[model samples]
Target: MLSHTRKNKILEILKRHKQISTQELEKQLSVSGATIRNDLTQLEEKGLIKRIHGGAVLPERESKNSFRSFHKRSEKNVEEKKAIGKVAKNYIENGQTIILDASSTVLYLLPYLTQYEKLTVITNGIYTALELKNEEDFNVILLGGIVRPKSGSVEGLIGSCMLNDISANLMITSAHGFNVKNGLTDFNFYEVELKKKMVEKSDRLIAVLDHTKIGHTSAAQFASSSEIDLLITDSQINDKDLKEIKDSGIEIIIGK
Candidate 1:
């Protein structure tokens, strides 16, 4: 196993117990004394934890480190996101109006989209606009509104007004969470409203979610399970959760 994997496990244990000794971690993780010491040192350097005598514990100011940027999140889950992006591309057609949501997965589609011509793309994502800015054939429309750097999308009245005029052939979107109870949810209220508007204006709504999003929920409710027309996810998704979503009449596409 990777050293980082061991470090993560040690951190999890420390998070639960607040503090632990090197001997206790060695016994629980079945690692050598040298390995435990190395991990503790590395964790301390990373600022995720602090060494206490023989063991390490989670940082004292954990709340300050909770928020992260979208750019950082984009690098993670790359394989799954690329797989979903490839499958989602199959739904696109030449000369079609496609609304690409502000998602890391949808951003992956830009590299593949150069093959198409005369397609009109609408979006609120700054990153997506910048990615496709050089492509000559595709007509790009960026919605103007309050920009949220963390989410990397536009929000507020201006964004809503922009969506009102445009109707897309397909609305390709992603979510922060996907649960049976909440369906699709986001952490931000304005984002929740903007997503709902996008769903409403599209002829068909396609949701691209990584395996991590399944059965998870956030604070804001945007739409229910029945609203989506299709869901594209990775092959590692649980069969039972896949069945539940598929049984609701939403087509499920699993990419390996």
Candidate 2:
């Protein structure tokens, strides 16, 4: 069986059972114990599953950190995310190429962006690409990679190589959390790795975050304060965090 197929099978079993022992996975998939363990490590690295002593289960907490919750992590703070997305749309216009990461907060910008007549959107978001489809004069390129079943977004860096030869007017995304020190962070290392590539290939980096995500930190840091050109967040962000944001010299747009 292909590695991806075998790995996916393991994930299916885990999802159905909620957790499964390495030995049982080997029995069901007819793969070696070593292979099953390696698969679990890969899934864990992507933040898809949590490994216990002898098995793996779904992540204990919601995926990712930022208002994206990783990808559309629920509607916990929907109104706040929409407000931030409105701020994000202000930076975009017609005839620009942009990279949009697959996050619920970033997802909110799609409706606002549909007003553009000529736009090229490059994204790792499966749902995002679908939303952009059928728009007049809009070209949507879905980054090629492994799709995380839960988030409906592509994972792994297989698709990021395309960005090396392409430059975008902007790259917009949300994070698991942020701090002046770590900058932007998320739970999955591979997602962060690809976001780093997008950051390098874009002219300006914009982080759209909700106030709740202002002070937190996640496992992996994708971009730092200096790399980000602007931050658009909700108004509830505290005075102290706002002060830190200003001190970092990154322009901020506080949404009403």
Candidate 3:
């Protein structure tokens, strides 16, 4: 198998089993113990896991502000995220004010955003702003606030106040979790508050989510099911989940 793929599988195994020995991976992948040790060493350098005397273990759960967690999470569900981003790009028009949230899923929209010109894109994502800063045709507004390094988001009153006077034609967002009952929820309180404000200030709230976010719930609540204007997700989403979201009177756009 490819080295990166093998490493990712190693991570998965470590996460579930807590700790994995080099001999175990050698037996599983039909590789030598030395190869497994090399893989573990690489993962350690990436900070995805910790290497003990004879095995590797998934790192302890750190604060949500931890960069390691955010970076690892952002690398997951990448294909589905690209599909969601592709669908979201189709809705943007030239010169329209678009507000995008700081979620990693929404970050996929950056590469596909080349079509719009002279547009106003407002966001609280530090990474997102940096991605678009070189586009001369776009007016990029980076919301100034307390930076949450783990999530790569900017939050607090500074961001909220900047959003108050600005209304967007479209607001593209994502959440850590969603449920039919709780609606859109987030793990961070500051992010939840900012997302709610973005919804209220925009004409349409489009949620760009991967299939994994379905039927989940997080710590903070933002909007009810009815508040979202559109839900853009991957085609891999379950039929039952699609039906439930549509049943709530929201438009569902599954990426083709």
Predicted model with the maximum TM-score: 2
Residue pairs in candidate 3 whose N, alpha carbon or C atoms collide under 3 angstroms:
none
Flag the better candidate by lDDT, 1 or 2.
2
Q: lDDT value for candidate 1?
A: 0.80
Cα lDDT over the full model 2: 0.82
Per-candidate TM vs. native? 0.73, 0.75, 0.73
- Can you tell me which runs of candidate 3 are displaced by over 4 Å? 1-68
Cα lDDT tens digits for candidate 2, 52-105? 999888765532322133344646678888888888888998899999998888
Query: What are the per-residue Cα lDDT tens digits for candidate 1 across 172-200?
Result: 99887897767987655566778888888
Ranking by lDDT: 2, 3, 1
User: Candidate 3's C-alpha lDDT?
Assistant: 0.81
Q: Which stretches of candidate 2 lie over 4 Å from their true place?
A: 1-74
> Over the stretch 25-84, how does candidate 3's per-residue lDDT look in tens digits?
888888788889898886676456789988887778412222345567779889999888
lDDT of 1 at 210: 92
Superposed Cα RMSD, model 2: 5.3
